[model samples]
Target: MTDWARFLPLSNRDRADDGGVSRDRSPAVASLLSAIAAVLDARPDLLAAPTLRPEVTVDAAVRELLSELGAPWWRRWARGVGALESPRPEVAAFADDALASALHARAAALAGPERRASIHDLRATVVLALELNAAHGAAIVVDPLLCGAVALDLALRSRLPERAVVTARSLVATDGEWRVGRGPELPAPGGAIVLFLAGRADVPPEDSAH
Candidate 1:
């Protein structure tokens, strides 16, 4: 399974309709990605946390991730954000079904066909990056230290007031206290999701078969 937490923070602060463009290399995004990568490289079991840490708020973590990776497209797009985003038909044409589904989901939520499409494309790109990392035999782990209970609480309350409290109660009860790192092995279910913010998932085909 892939880590979804690392990428969760990158959700645009402003919906595309409101002229919110997400930076691809913000310090916040970079930091979060770095933290994830560091933990993955050392241990592959920390992905299972009761809740993320206080400092691991979705936006802050995503900005940190953008900073760590050299990719500046997100930053560029965010700065030039207008009613429309750049067209990426070729990208859309190339994505697979799972990726396409996710991309379509984001596109439908935002405004501006191009911007919406771009959001979907970017999600696929992130997924591909994780695939490459896994193929390389890189140890994958989640940062148990980053707690997200508070942020999740706020998000649930704001987005789904009716279900937020109930959902939060369930997650908090099922998951224990969030911690620092994981042991040698992760404690998640088989095929659990890993929190991957960003990395080089688009590796060359030839290079992938190491």
Candidate 2:
């Protein structure tokens, strides 16, 4: 079983690395979503309508649900800081990861060969998920768990906006960092710019040469 204790809320005894994340990441993700919307806006002819924000609130709500399913470790710690209940933490973590990973894999498969760009979209989506998860400090489980959560999040969030159609790849963090490559632009015609972002995995062997 995967060692879920690493991500089980306040399981981190260090306290310093406990259930916390970078303050800037939320806005960064919001900006990327906004950027995608902006690009879609520029190509009125391609889409049937203007771009809109994805209903990511729903996904966030789900995460909230997960948090509430039982008292999160952080919450418990904040209250009094006691020992964990130890309810098959490894199994739960493994199950969550498996489900999330499958979701992303299916998404990639659905991209279809007609649009190579969809692959790129998938890449971006995956990268965004990893980055967000890492920033939130939720990536304490295994790759499967991290990948799965990210995939499910993207699938739920992509429902809104222009439905421009996107896909993502497996996010592997190299050197103790999240590594990713943004895919090509949407298949929007015209001389529109195709933008993609790449990142490193959140593993070991840190790449200090930026």
Candidate 3:
């Protein structure tokens, strides 16, 4: 597995060598991204709908991940919303809207009033997730949303390689700092990528977080 912890903010020892501030990582971050990837991998068809928000894509991903992880009941409800092979565009759009609203509400409730994330932030969050996937490769988890963020990034990276690289750098500088808590209640695995998105950074010569 990727040494996910090495991506977090630098420790005193780490700073002693790097001499700069770094981003932090948490378990919620890992689970959230993993969930996002699971959903997208399961349903590439969503990409055909350009009007949908990233959150809608995320909701689909989350539902698929849950089902794969043994939440069959959720899978049933999720399928009722809209299946990948749904025959009607109108029906699929309606289901997408419903699922997106549900996900927005749940994310808001979890974030609470203190750190309630805006739709814009969520949208940007999705972009960050996609960029990581692109840089690191989707299959390996890149040590890694918030929808088209990945799709859009992938498109740009493919067409304008240099510009896309520059944009990705700017994204890391801005989006990289934000962290997701996954709340304190969820039972997450130790050393899992948690509480925030990942960015482009040099790997340490040796493992540090363990």
Candidate 4:
């Protein structure tokens, strides 16, 4: 199992998309691939099972992973999003029945043209990957400390709803040295708080934590 967390540094905030022009941001791709591999390797049964992370199933996550990974070009041909995301030839082309072939081809495709997809979309995949990684446990995450810190950093950077209760949270990771919040501390495994923030895991919010 690969450690998907250390694939990118926790401090990396420089990867926000820039006009969707073109750049090869391979780190996110590598990280996501590593995460997916780790997840599947540990629990092949999850391929047909519910990830229990809301709308996404592990299989669907794989399909979307390919779609998002290929968005650089297919997005242009996209007629609609969400439910209408399918029928895209690019995605269809990548969606080989053989999952390994699909993932391999897509990885090569990302490095093909200068037209790059959004790295944020890939990060979103990481969160979903975590939902899958939940079954795999700490082994899949090579650097839990870094992953936890990065996860918290990501939660803080994410846009919250208007008057959202989760805003300004001070989260502490019991398994690591990372802690953030001026108010009464909300402590848990660093990754769980992150999953909760993403609505991937159901963890109740504690007192003021920002």
Considering every candidate listed, which one attains the maximal lDDT? 4
- Candidate 1 lDDT over residue span 8-56, tens digit each: 3223223444254233212222233343444434543322221133333
Q: Where is model 2 poorest over a 10-residue stretch in terms of lDDT? A: 188-197
State TM-scores per candidate.
0.24, 0.22, 0.25, 0.59
Please give the CA lDDT of all the candidate structures. Answer: 0.29, 0.30, 0.33, 0.53
Error of 3 at 23 (Å): 13
Q: Per-residue lDDT of 59-157 in model 2, one digit per residue for the tens?
A: 332222222223444653553333543233432353432333433333343344432222223334435433333333333222332333333334333
Report lDDT (Cα) of residue 75, candidate 2. 55
Instruction: For candidate 3, give the lDDT of residue 178.
Output: 23
Error of 1 at 75 (Å): 10
C-alpha lDDT of residue 204 in model 1: 14
lDDT tens readout by residue for model 3, 4-90? 232232211334654432222223333354444454455545434322233443344434322232123444455557753322233
Q: What is the lDDT of residue 206 in candidate 1?
A: 22
Provide the lowest-lDDT 10-residue window in model 1.
189-198
Q: What is the lDDT of candidate 2?
A: 0.30
Which structure among the candidates has the greatest TM-score? 4
* Model 1 RMSD in angstroms: 17.6
How far residue 208's Cα lies from its native spot in candidate 1, in Å, is: 38
Q: What is the number of backbone collisions in each predicted candidate, taken in the order shown?
A: 37, 28, 12, 8
Runs in model 3 deviating more than 4 A are: 1-8, 12-62, 65-94, 113-128, 131-210
